[model samples]
Target: MDPKIKSLPTMAFPQISGIAALGFAFLIVLGNVFLVPAGLPHAGAETGEVIAFFTTSKDIVGIASMLTPLAWVLATLFGAGAVSVLWQSDRDRGEAWSLVGFGGLILQNGAFAAVIAIRLALASTTAHDSTATTELWALHDALFMLNGTFLTLALIGLSISGLRAGLIRQWHGRLGLLAAALLFSSATLAPLIMDQAGPLGLLGLIGWLMWVVWVGTYGITLIRGGAVPIESQSHATSSKP
Candidate 1:
């Protein structure tokens, strides 16, 4: 191995992955704060128009245009680390389960991509005035459950690995579990924002965004510091999930 490269087994890939994950987290937050609001309509007798306005905002446009692909790339990075850290080992009973959990991450994020595609489809079909657009959005709402499912599986897999392998500190493991719960709850409340303004709706977004941010940076400091548990782990953690 090249001396410099040999010093870091993964060739400092984790740092690059961290940067990408942070960028993706920022975009998701940006979409939630500015673009998501625009797509929804404000209160009053014109509530439907208000909901439609935010639902169809340029932000959602930007999401389908840019963020979906970005999410796929970022997810791949996380998946790398996860594959290495959680699923590659026979040390824990959860190894096979973590594989399944992170596998859900792939599927869940795919669902989000589906949502973005559905949004873009709705926008494109508007010019023709088709009933299919409405049907699609309803389907999109249902599909969003996948993202929450992804989070739940991600946290569960890691949390189980943490307990069994002693891979992560207790706090981070607990936080991972909590974040999963928040993410799942968000799916229920996301569509409610259309019915009326409510704290649960806003809190759900905030919680989920925070969840994304937290997960992105989790284990990063240890990974860079060359912590023993991380380095000596039996399998590779792809950082993808």
Candidate 2:
């Protein structure tokens, strides 16, 4: 290690990270659950329907958007914590998967910020501005669907790193990987799916649910300090010479 390089205080924030992760998951779920049933427009909703929803449900939409900023903040903190915890193992293995995961987290935060901004813009527009609302909503749907790509990257990077580092359980890693696959598939089909709302949308929805569960599980595990594999323990011992 370079003499000037400062090591991360990895041991100092597992509990805090765990709580942040849980909070991120909770906020996402709360926003979706609260909005979806309150007549949030579907992906293929007609322009008139979209306009009406935004105009009438402005309060609900505002409430949901309000959760997004805090959720993104919590997600960034959790991502940093995860990267810190995996840094040593990644260095030993000559890998940067945790960093990749962190990048994805940051990118998703930006992407979702744009999504929410568009939503708020729509909410503020009058129904008379149908053309503008239609265009904006279309942009929103496209961005929302494509945002799955960032989620996919985050899941894949973290799943691989956590599993290799023995920091997360096999089932947890598998869940993350599975969610990544689903989310990636959804993003790949974004053009087609965004054109029509149906069972196809369920792909991303299922992936999102899995992602939430995976995040929550990871948080709980981190709070418990995780379990080191025997091989990792041996490697650490051997490196101490």
Candidate 3:
């Protein structure tokens, strides 16, 4: 490393944020496997199936729902760190992608929280009113639509930014592009067919899985990149005055 680069301030914020985000993702997967009962139906499932799932998994689901907000908040922090790192690479041009990526993440997390909130509220019903349950489930799916859209934009924006900045590898960028394409296609085409379990839907699911991997790698890249030139540049500017 150049002496100037080596002399730049080092920060662990991005690394810590990355680890936290990964931990939160792990927690979600674990919650689904152990806390939530298996064979649960989806938001677009039949009324009886939906009720059955809630009946079986309400308490555990509620617990997970309660914890999700915190998880997303940590994700948001990591996302911001991602933006910071990208900004350092190309200040003027990177700004647009960084802002879009940050906004997308915030919206995605907020929508996720809203979906959980709606579900949690429905779960509180002692008696499973079929009408109320069905409506809430519909709302949950709708929220997921919005969440999915934001997620697609987030990955696309971040991937492109990271690609241009050389912060992430080319293969990683391509993976993100593929994931984004799958999600966008699903978001637009699947609803037309009204097939939640159709090809597009499966694509979306695969995309989501890819998203987890993409984010994990993205966070790690950000962590490994470290905060140097940004801090150092600002310091140099301040000292000049």
The lDDT leader among the candidates is 2
Supply candidate 3's per-residue lDDT for 53: 72
lDDT of 2 by residue, 155-194 (tens): 9988999998899988999999999999989889988898
For each candidate, give its TM-score against the true structure: 0.70, 0.90, 0.82
Clashing pairs in 2: none
Pairwise lDDT winner, candidates 1 and 3 = 3
For model 3, which pairs clash?
none
All candidates in order of lDDT, best leading: 2, 3, 1
Give me the displacement of residue 149 in model 3, in angstroms. 0.7
* Cα lDDT of model 1 by residue, 1-241, tens digit: 7888777755455555555556666666665565544544222114245336534574566554575677677766765555555454533333475575567667767778787786666555445333554456557655654367676777777566654555557777777777777767766655665445566555455556656756656536325532226543543344324
> Per-residue lDDT for 152 in model 1?
73
Candidate with the larger TM-score of 2 and 3: 2
Alpha carbon lDDT at 218, candidate 3: 78
Per-residue alpha-carbon lDDT of candidate 3 for residues 30-114, written as tens digits (9 for 90 to 100): 6567443555565467889878877877777777776786778777887888776666554544247766777888888888878
Name the regions of candidate 1 deviating beyond 4 angstroms.
Answer: 1-10, 41-60, 88-94, 126-130, 185-203, 222-241
Clashes of each: 28, 0, 0
